[model samples]
Target: MNSEHTKTALVLGALSGLRTLSATAVLSHYLRYNSNLKIKNRRLKFLNSAGFALLSKLLATGEIAIDKSPNIPDRVRPGGLSGRTLSGALVGAAIYSINKRRIWKGALIGATSALAATFLSFYTRKQITRNTRIPDQVIGTVEDVIAVGGSVAVLEGDR
Candidate 1:
């Protein structure tokens, strides 16, 4: 696989670690607008649909709002981690498929990156919150920006 494809998978996966739906939302939006793409997988065709794009964006926005709540479970929790991993895998596979490369490789890289980033980001956020005494909501907002901005950068850079 090309290094650029691998890099995109890794970055999107890491962003998924921060917000499970963010990468998929951005990717769906990208796919929706870029009509020249020729994705062969029928299952992935939904990524190009306006309805799917809208739904993913709404879900991502909801995730962002709920993420700021103290009652929300840690992202490293089994359920959260699994969702993020799946999100990473989906987007990674989509990226590779769009590039006419092997989707499995991208899925593997994306899932692994998401798994690693989940723990790393969790601890890093905890440390920053503990050390700086800043509200977690503020940190989470910053993380949202990173996830959203990073997703956009990775996908747009590929063009």
Candidate 2:
């Protein structure tokens, strides 16, 4: 795949590591609004649908809200990490499919980046919260902003 596509996958994947549904939500929103871009894969056609866009947005919003709660599990946990990895893989594959490139390569890069970012972000957040004396909720909100803003920036950069 080209450098542009690779960059897209990596950025979106890292965003997924921060917030599992954020990348997919942004991607679905992009696909829904950008009628000029079409998904060549039939299976991924749902990503461009209004229903999927709405559902993804709702889920992402809920995830952001719940992320602040102390009851929520750490993202480094197996289930959370796997979910992030899958989200990255899906977003990466969708991007590659849209560009008519190799989906497997995109998936691999996305998954790997997401896995690494999960650990990196988790530890960094932990350290910041411990050393800076900032509330985790606040730090989490900042992370949410990074994920959402970063996703938007990456997709917009492509256009």
Query: Each prediction's TM-score against the native?
Result: 0.96, 0.97
Off by over 4 Å in 2: none
What pairs collide in candidate 1? Answer: none
What's the distance in Å from true for residue 133, model 2? 1.4
Per-residue error at 124 for model 2, in Å?
Answer: 0.2
Among these predicted structures, which one has the highest TM-score? 2
Query: Residue-wise lDDT of candidate 2 within 1-159, one digit each (tens)?
Result: 489989999999999999999999999999989975667788788999999999999999999999999999999999999999999998988888889987888888889889999999999999999999899999999999999999999999987
Poorest lDDT segment (10 consecutive residues) of candidate 1:
34-43
TM-score of predicted model 2? 0.97
Worst 10 residues of 2 by lDDT: 35-44
List candidate 1 segments past 4 Å from native. none
What is each predicted model's overall lDDT from 0 to 1?
Answer: 0.90, 0.92
